[model samples]
Target: MKHQTERQAWMEILAKSSVVNIERQVQTLGKLPEYSFLRSPEIGLTMLRGRAGGTGEVFNLGEMTITRCVVKILDTIGFGYVGGRSKRHAELAAVCDGLLQQNEWSFTVQNQVIQPLQTIIQQKQEQQQRQTEATKVEFFTMLRGE
Candidate 1:
């Protein structure tokens, strides 16, 4: 269960990160192990669903384009799914996933690649939150008696 949670966290970070950011961080890892594609990167559409008025009935929001790839490195397999049609992004994500699964490379990959990417993501979220708060409005009522 712990292992699954850790993978889930890292995978979420990978999915949220931009391809350029991920690629930049990955470049610091030096030589990468050879990997073969288990499933070639492919683009497809997934239906998006949304709720009306936050808690009302759900409705289809429309379809979004996504690209997915699977790769095998040694005995472990990795999968990557990203929004849009960037095949290279999907491939790089798969490579990172595969490396993160191996005991020998997990620590290095997590520190050098995943941690920085996660930091960048957190910073962006914080900035957005601050911006939203800045626009917050407050309302009050004044009473008049006859």
Candidate 2:
């Protein structure tokens, strides 16, 4: 597997993170640094696109509720876009993103937040794959002797 850049990894973590999980983790980080919201957390709708049966025609699935925010920590800017309508989640994600950009907190945040979240996400995916594979069906046919 190709090595993932720091920014890319954090982006994934922020996107996939659970609202409660993120809230809890961020709470443990103690007081936040001085920062301002470039954009306050706001809920919006985004078009969801889907491919039929994973190989068929593409179609509009539906509209999904999304919350987004942007924050600036010192000279660095960070953004968060999360699925669902939780404003708090978006805010925390934005804050965490900004913290992750800072050199002083990057390694600590990576080990405490991003790394553990990645592990949890990986485990969930593996469990899902196992469950799906367990339900697989195989068909076979045997020739009859004439």
lDDT of 2 by residue, 35-138 (tens): 89899999999999999998899999999999999999877888988899998888878888888888898888888888878888889999999999999999
TM-score, candidate 1, is 0.89
lDDT (tens digit, per residue) of candidate 1 on 1-146: 44568888888788889999999999999989899999999999999999999799999999999999999987899999988899998999889999999999999999999999999999999999999999999977668762
* Ten contiguous residues minimizing lDDT sum, candidate 2: 23-32
Clashing pairs in 2: none
TM-scores, one per candidate: 0.89, 0.83
Query: Model 2 shows how many backbone clashes?
Result: 0
True-structure lDDT of candidate 2: 0.85
